[model samples]
Target chain A: MKEEKNIHTNSEVLVKVEGLSKKFCKDLKTSLWYGVKDLTANVFGNKNVRQLRDKEFWAVKDINFELRRGECLGLIGHNGAGKSTLLKILNGLINPDEGKVTIRGRVGALIELGAGFNPILSGRENIYNNGAVLGFSKKEIDEKVEAIIDFSEIREFIDMPVQNYSSGMKVRLGFAVAAQMEPDVLIIDEVLAVGDIGFAMKSFNAISQILKTSAVIFVSHSMPFISRICDNIILMDKGKMLLKTNDVGFGVQSYFDNQKLLGALNFGEENIILNNVKIHSENPRLEGIIEYGKKSIFEINIDSLNDYPKVKVSILVYNMAQINVALFESRYISIKSIKGQKFIFDFGDSFLSISNYFITVRFDDLDNKKALVVSNYVNYRSFQVTGAERLVFAPLYLKEKI
Target chain B: MPLETRIYQKENHLKLGHLFKASFKDMLSSRFLAKQLAVRDIKAQYRQSFFGILWAFITPMFTALVWVFLSRSGTVTLTETGAPYPVFAFTGTLIWSIITESINAPTASTKSAKGIMSKINFPKEALVLSGVYKLLFNTCIKTLLLLFFVFFYGVGFHVSQLFFPLAILMAILFGTTIGLFLTPIGMLYNDVGKIISVGLSFLMYVTPVVYVIPKEGLMKTIMELNPLTPLILTSRDLILGNPPAFLNYFLILFAVSALLFSVALVFYRISIPILVERSNA
Candidate 1:
């Protein structure tokens, strides 16, 4: 089945990482001492190698993947899931403790915006400096300088010191330089969220232009953006790979499901508590797929020890990346009597896209200031927007008159 | 697509020749970047200062003036330097400053770029090369000042003076060799930079910078033992039309400097990444 699904007949692998791992020490003094010891061991003919020592742990381990030309790989993980560490290792900013990474062709990275820019230098000068740091020749920068400045939209401020440029301008210029370099492999780490929406669109268009020829590895918390750009996805957790698949929808669903199992939600200490939460459709037999433009109901069961004066219930719908997509709240109809009551949220028509989503149930006071019970259930249920046109740029399908 | 890059843990067995060749090529490819960095530093070094580039010559010139005043006041007895006291002291201090500045340049440059180094991957040799460029610029300014001092003191020019630039170059190479060796350590610990600053000032007195080396004494023996003593003496001899003294010692030291610099480059290539990672961690 896997062989049959292999689509690219002439694609070549641009980046191959095999069993790569990196260990980091928690304590500064111990880390420095470990560095010295490692250096000495390298200098000497000592072959003894241990994976971990005191105060040290693997930040990334046994990560294996191959990126091919014209492919965009999405790296989805929660914070501290070793995504940044993996990017650093691939970019050659840091060394790995074990395994090997073989890369073909030049690698351009927007790892951090304006990372190598000298604040005292003018924007024009920093363009040259940044290009050089990215391994561009002076003649190459000279040829592309005008286009870079034009793309950044900071032509007027090009002669001003970079310290004077705003943060948005800095990112614009940074992305321009990296994009113009035409690297064979491009690695972007959540740098697209910078600038206003217009600039973000422009930058994404530039990325798409580059995607035609170069392999890309991008990490973003925006699921919509990921689905729009990525052809393959890898889900990571606590320095380990959990899933790697080409189906963007399934990969996003798996990521949310894993987050639900691992993330510990902080519940409020109050008289009322959530007993259970379930999603139901019109057809009781149907499971795991909610067809678009159909009715769906969220049933939340509450268990209370005593009656309360005023109580409100709310259900928040979140995308896999934990971004809130919709909210269902019982604000107008208050629960004066807090007996074990079931709150049913009915949506006339569901417009959610084909992806995983989270349901967070919360019982709050009358003013919504105090939470009686807070339960964050990630990937509580997943639905597919079947028989509808796929919306890759956004999860919500709003009816418009345009 | 013609090149394949593989990264892994460094091996225990050192390939000295391969390391040298690779590092040399990397440094050569990064020359334009190094030039940009150097240009940034040179422009920023004096941008906000009122004295601007004058500060480069003022400090050493003031030191020379103090020594000349003391010598004329007869408060401190001094051995006869072959040239006029002011010219001798000025030239000596100027060369000594070049040594000290070159030694400090690499460490300072690398430290300042620590933020960028940890965040970005580039040919780090560019930083060292940029520091060298700054040293060359400063040395050129100081050389012009030295010419002024020679004319002001009415010291006649000699054909041998043509080799003065070579002497200065040697001093810079010697200092930069030591500096490159210390850069990794200096970047790791703040104390290394502080100690160098204080130690270089104290070391000046032990070298024959202002006065001639005594014929026989503890200070003379210490001065003779100092490696910089021969370098400074040879540079001064070359500029003053005297057959350079300690030519054999200078030759030996030059060879040692080259070897140490090569070794330091290897060590630097290996250690800098670790140091940068540690700092970020």
Candidate 2:
């Protein structure tokens, strides 16, 4: 009977799940009348799918987990912190008003990667229509269609028509046919946050060669690709699992210590005001974060509503995909009729690497040498940096001895 | 390594014999993703047409030439259709446009595969079997224009007209069993696909496709309680050859439309994961 159910059992759990949940409604006509009363109480059986009716909610709660054959879990949160509804209920694509998932062999989902592309066909016929919707088999997409047209380098526009290619050559031929879907468990949403960077390091090395014999889960916000191929993690927020771990760097440092610190200070056209914006960090841990190449300072205080022999402030910073890595400025710190004045700056050994950052500041008017008027603010302040050693890709680790 | 577990609960603990044996084993492993999504939707449906595949023989020869020019200018009065009213109204609107394109092929092939079923988890019975393989490739070009209108209207051939592809596969299995029981409320309401194309054009003016079933009053008792009047009068009497005037009411409406097409494929596999979790984004 199919070779007694093909019994090759090495580390075998494959994926378990359990206490999972789903809910969700936030009104689309009362979530389509609670999806036609939970699909007529689940097609006439009517077990009443455990509570919470009107205005629903729990977009995946109680989500327990498991994964064996070469484990990898990770699912960190924020962005409706349900982590793509628990990877669409572990890729069965929905249905978990309560719990229990199971799964075993075949699951593959690096989501929407050319999901059945056919922009008038032809990228070698959408690689056999996205390799027969990722289940493969037209003689295994004709023996992996010449390595998916040589890892989607376009191969002279693989016979033309995918609506004339370019959109980074249709996301590098949809990540080379979802990296030739081998599938044992694999899930991976945020399909490597979309292309470009040598095809995201050749699809992160074809998803680390299909994560060395499957059993993944992933979902990300890229806490360094979830601390590089996660061993286990969870985090999630609004819909439960505040933290689950197998350490993966303290579950990605408690998902950046449950991030919320935006540190508001807007006063746009209020000219110049703020009285204290600190950020000292000699080696501050969690709460203030900053440790990597330690020495920091950012004082500020300020008041100057009018006089100015010179001013020029600037700051900038950013990162956390906000990009603008670093910049400083200052030089003319007179603020003539200065009030609370403070000023500081320093930031000695701050090479910037670990992560979280913000800061926009700006105050000018160096006697209008066209440095015109003053005060600006936007995303005013925020901070976090912690290291010890982990700079695989570097946003800024410049120790510069070379 | 085909361990094959796949549990996923909450459908009242499933087990209707494992949901009809996993919906007939994912409709037999979605036959090569329903023939590669019906050859990538029949080659992107005629690669942006320009008379490509002659627009499926010019849409049922232009709705049978506007009902053969409104019953030859009588403006709509019609009766006595033994065969030859423009080849019996172009084989009754080419078998009523293959039973209204098999009742709009399982909700227009699951709404043009709603962006690949909300980010892939295949075997959605390959989008209603790739809409019955693009309604049998536009019913093989409306069966070669109903064999060139039964030999250009002379209406000769007979071996029971070789059962006209089994009466066009019993009008696409009884219009895909009431379009798979109106595709779980037409994939959750667009008013059940605009009330099934305005109730199949007012149900093609009460059945008999383009007039014929009337032999008495009350429009022949509403065309004998219209179950598509024995599948368009046995596919226009096996395409004008004859001997099939409701052959036992077309074998009891093809055994009650093959038992309502296996109860509309087990109510389309228990309402497609609750209509894919309320039509996911």
Candidate 3:
């Protein structure tokens, strides 16, 4: 019987979603009672009827993805990108209107910290409640209870109501419950951003340890975290998956760049979306590593604009090599601020040591703080000094360095 | 992929027995919360009134008193056989009112419990089911009051009246069916309450709650179509020792209950996904 059913199932892959769609119903439908009156021609026009006139909200459309075992897939998206909804569907919290989410393993999700937890209940009470909600039996909860409590480090207050607990405590308990649940598949939905930095580090460490045994799906805005943790990144926007990438910085930059590329902005002629950014201005032969005290100038040419836009321009240079550096100050003078305007500043023998540097261009007037044009990356232009670099921001320069 | 699709089918089409058991467990665990909510509903209904829950008894008593006055004035005849006219009207109205409240419950509870659903990932049916639970509690209270009157007013019960609960079940079954079908529509439609309001009360009177039975064919057809008629009559039969059509009420109630539950499960499954997705997580 199972084989017969499988034969009927179109097995393209394990999980095949051809064209997923979701529509949201409004809270107070205008077709409410007011519509009845209006349809009967009692009033001029029914506000309720007008509101109910046409309220069909589509949240997700044509969403498609496939996941296999041992894949640490990262979902990077902006707010309301439907990542959490997708996760919730995967976790069996709710059923989608027009989509299919297929999974083989016992999927586990930390979609939000303490998603079903009750504030009035004590931590101990919540453990059982939450565990039960997650589909664990009472006996299973009893067995994992000790490890969960110990990991959360809320033993002292475990018996106290969660309303009395701090935010950190909530996340801790939530994380501990998930960690101890030992699911085959784990999903983290930006909840890791909570808690202290140290605790975050500890949580990620625990996550990494768990990754050895399970597949992980993570949603985050932290690019570096995605880069370091996930094997591949899937970028989503609105309800669509825009790009899938293996490179960390490139993927992060692409996500930001895609927004500008695909945003509902009417691009005038002479306006460029800045498709590809590269800084390859070869100078007096800098070697593999630019050492300390070697004078270097970063020459950068930004390629953008369909047609040269008429506007003045300035570039903000940044040192991105994890070196102690000040905020970048805009120090370029461009007569034209229009599109396709390129301006470069030669930091001739600047007081900066060997490090990777980038420059970003932002266009805006002072009035409304509106940033008309912004690039995720400055320029790929990087320079290094060709000598021994001991001190950072060097020019602890000794006069008589024999 | 098809198997996966089957597995991902919406709103867990749990077997009926399993669903009932799970809901039962949830209600049991949440009994304290249910009590708290029912108390709030009951108290809120009569808040700041001198006669509070006594009002539950008061409404039926006044209705009966009006009937008495009408009879004394020779305005109308109650046409009672086994009991006094006032006692007859009082018992029927009291039972029917509670049952009607039960039918109207799922709608009201769905509207009121939006606060809970929006904030928590609870079983949404809890709100709907709790309404029936509250009605059950209310029904018990009303039944006890009726029993007191039956004894005090010297109305006797036959040995066959042991099946009063079976009659109550018919009422509940019909009530739950109607409640389940309308609650989600109520959640979706803003004016559902008003529609149910004027419509259901008219339905109550037509179902033979407060008057003598008319023997016209049209009246019988209307009575047959009322859905609550069998419930009221069967319950009256159990009390008054009429040859109760127990099997007929059982089949009708059972079939209607199944239909309502199935419809409710479908609506719940369809809406729950959208509800969660649209929530401000």
Output the number of the TM-score-best candidate.
1
Candidate 1 has a TM-score of 0.83
Q: Where does candidate 1 stray beyond 4 Å?
A: A1-10, A45-47, A261-355, A359-402, B10-14, B73-75
Task: Give each model's whole-structure lDDT.
Answer: 0.77, 0.77, 0.58
lDDT of 1 by residue, A1-402 (tens): 123223434388889999888888999888878877766565453355556899988888889999988899999888889998888888887777777777877788877767678787899988988888888899999999999999999999999999888989999999888778676788989988779999899988988887877789999866768888998999998888989999887788777666654343436654555555656567745644566657666666666665555665666677655567877665433443365677666655676765556666666664445654533432344444454745545424222111
> Candidate 3 DockQ category?
incorrect
lDDT of 3 by residue, A253-320 (tens): 55554544323222233233433223222343443233444433333344453332333233344443
TM-score of 2: 0.36
lDDT (10s digit) by residue, model 1, range B20-109: 777788789889989988988777777668998889788667888899899999988898886888888877888898899889888888
For candidate 1, give the lDDT of residue A213.
Answer: 75
The lowest-lDDT stretch of 10 consecutive residues in candidate 2 chain B is B11-20
lDDT of 2 by residue, B141-251 (tens): 877877887888789788877877888888888898889888877777788888889988998888887778767889789888888888877777877877676789789
Residue A235 in model 1: lDDT? 94
Query: TM per model?
Result: 0.83, 0.36, 0.61
User: Any runs in candidate 3 off by more than 4 Å, and if so which?
Assistant: A1-63, A80-82, A88-100, A116-129, A138-180, A198-210, A259-402, B1-161, B210-225, B239-242, B245-250, B263-281
The order of the candidates by TM-score, greatest first, is 1, 3, 2
